[model samples]
Target: MINDKVLAIILGGGQGSRLHPLTEERSKPAVPIAGKYRLVDIPISNCINSNIKRMFVLTQFNSASLNRHIKDTYHFSFFSSAFVDVLAAEQTPENKGWFQGTADAVRQSMHHLLRHEFEYVLILSGDQLYQMDYDLMIKAHIKNKAKISIATIPVNAKDATSFGILKADDKNLVTSFVEKPDTSLLPEWNSDVSNEMKAQGRNYLASMGIYIFNKDLLIDLMSNPDTIDFGKEIIPQSIHEHKTLSYQYEGYWTDIGNIDSFFEANIGLTADIPEFDLYNKSKRIYTRARMLPTTKVSGTTLNKTVIAEGCIISAAKIEQSVIGIRSRIGDESTIINTYMMGSDYYQTLDDVNNSKINIIGIGARCFIKNAILDKNCCIGNDVRINGGNHLEDTETKTYAIKDGIVVIKKGAVIPNGFVL
Candidate 1:
């Protein structure tokens, strides 16, 4: 029963620097999403839903949290023919180096892959938020007999310069690829238009950085590459010789590369018609689910928010937020548009005005507007931090809330009645 025809390789090796302090302690894939799931959960869950079982997750850049997450969430035992594993970077005798780029990461792992009998390899990124039926793309690839198939979508022509744009034929065959080209040089520009002023219409198709390749072709190209990227090197060079097709996938796909985008993606999931649904029991998304009691909202006004297990919200007003487990919100505090991480002993018992109360754990607070409070923050009572328009005018490093909310560093405590 040698049925490993398709092998999925997820590239989780990069240290996402663009995400700043969020990635300071954990890998980008390990960053919490929607107060419950991690970034890597999207791809792994998609692979499971698509019926592609044999997979490997490549990790680098402080993978302790990510590795623990994978171990806890993905519990599939390997049989004689099927398995899912996480392969961190290792220094072998032949290649004692770190993964340099996207293409280089795959190149480093080719030794193990070549020994297995797989027909196709699906290469993907770990930082995207999307629900895709990759089997459909695979079927399209096999039907077209394409040596390579790239999943792509239409972007605004002006913004296309920021992405890898593909010039595909009517048959979806990729003719040319431009990686983040200067849009100002376009023929659509006029004399009054500065190169930076060129705006593209929403018609250009950009590569989604998701690729399906014939095992042989992928190995051959990776073996000999000058640059260490697929878009920058392999794909651009391969257009001359191979039948590379572009498969357009129109679904919810977002590259959550930065804190703002990451925040937006999580908030987007709570929409009335969300693109991705974690509540879908049939398409169960796997993550490290901690064992905690059900969330309790006693005398709290919660509207259009998601509260995970082990959370105690007593006498608070919460709206449009995602709350994690074991976090305690104090009475009389108003929480809005925020995300919290769950852990035991995040909050301490406090005496507020002759009454016993549980104060907000680290990073817990009343965010009256668009603000992101990172993990493990203890926000004290009588703290009125505004994320509204004029509240961002203040200039303080630790307390002055920027970008709609104050970001309290992990393990920091805000004393009671503290106003920033």
Candidate 2:
């Protein structure tokens, strides 16, 4: 019954400039991750696992792929009220411009939200990687009789400066808030965290950008157009005026805000025991159930690699990589610390043999390290891309170098013996 009274809004971030080439063609939420799943799948799967089925994803930029993914992936009984919808910004008689910030996006879409029956609104970031049961947060909110609740994670001082830090009382009631506070002010902003967290030097509570607001409070807050962002405006302004509870979550959570974090999150899956467990049956990460065949590999030395379905890998060695679906790697190639987002569709034998173009996937005798191969890439033979601190950041038509990681653009064709 509690689940029925809750509605979820997942905010797909703005242009996602930090994620540059990856967001060049698709929305942030639609960006593929862990080889097969989209970034949006994280929040949607979390909501579903928490029994909160009604959700609306708010996205504006390049949402076509995100729209298609949601439509194809999530399906429920025709008679059931459960559904996931994508709400892109639209020009209206009242507001014409794009979403100014987080609050603005939800404000513009409130008309559609009012039609649904809900008591509380659960707001989530679409670009985050984490697994959590939101039902517990909602329960805490009800028990504490709070008007708003924020999911806070204990972060060390070094990591706290980049987040909206919160100071909570012994009762877990947020007392003060600061957005990306200076390092010098960290001592005054410390919150009482678990002994385990304290031992690890994670003393401050950082807002996870996850919130639960009473339906009435959210509707009231959205009326003020001046307060555009929750973290920047709504939260700091309302903390003193309202009873806001802090729901502490100590889990494997990462905000995939840029290409670097995104790359690390995907590659981290190859760990012997990954912090973000994909093997958990109870908290399964749901995605489109494509009838894909098992990945086929031959004589490849795989070490700490996670390969998705429908891959044909004949690489000499693949170490610490996440190989996606429908991938076709040629022989004698070596891949290390890479995330290869495999092709959308498999290349037919006729096309591979007859076409005077490079094949879709890695070519023979290539050495790719510390890179990301986007979907449907045509890597030529004998290409050697060794990414490291030695190379400066640069971008070309076919690929980009960010923080020493070579990212091959989607559908790009690298010439034979190309070296980076």
Best-matching candidate per TM-score: 2
lDDT of 2 by residue, 1-420 (tens): 898999999999899999989999999999999999999999999999999999999999999999999999999999999999999999999899999999999999999999988999999999999999999999999999999999999999999999999998889999999999999998899888889999999999999999999999999999998989999999999999999999999999999998899999999999999999999998999999999999999999999999999999999999999999999999999999999999999877888997685689999999999998999999999999999889899999999999999999999999889999
**lDDT, candidate 1, 260-378, per-residue tens:** 68777876765776777777776778777677777877788877787777887774688777777677776667877766665534443443232344344632344334656666666
- TM-score for all models, in order of appearance: 0.87, 0.99
lDDT of 2 at 91: 97
lDDT value, residue 210 of candidate 2? 99
Residue pairs with colliding backbones in model 1 are: 157-200, 158-200, 310-326, 361-377, 361-378, 362-377, 362-378, 363-377, 363-378
Show model 1 residue runs off by greater than 4 Å.
1-3, 78-80, 185-201, 344-368, 388-405
Question: Candidates' lDDT values, in order?
Answer: 0.73, 0.95
What is candidate 2's TM-score against the reference?
0.99
Q: State in Å the error of residue 44, model 2.
A: 0.2
Model 2 residue 370 distance off true place after TM-score fit, in angstroms: 0.4
Error of 1 at 76 (Å): 1.5
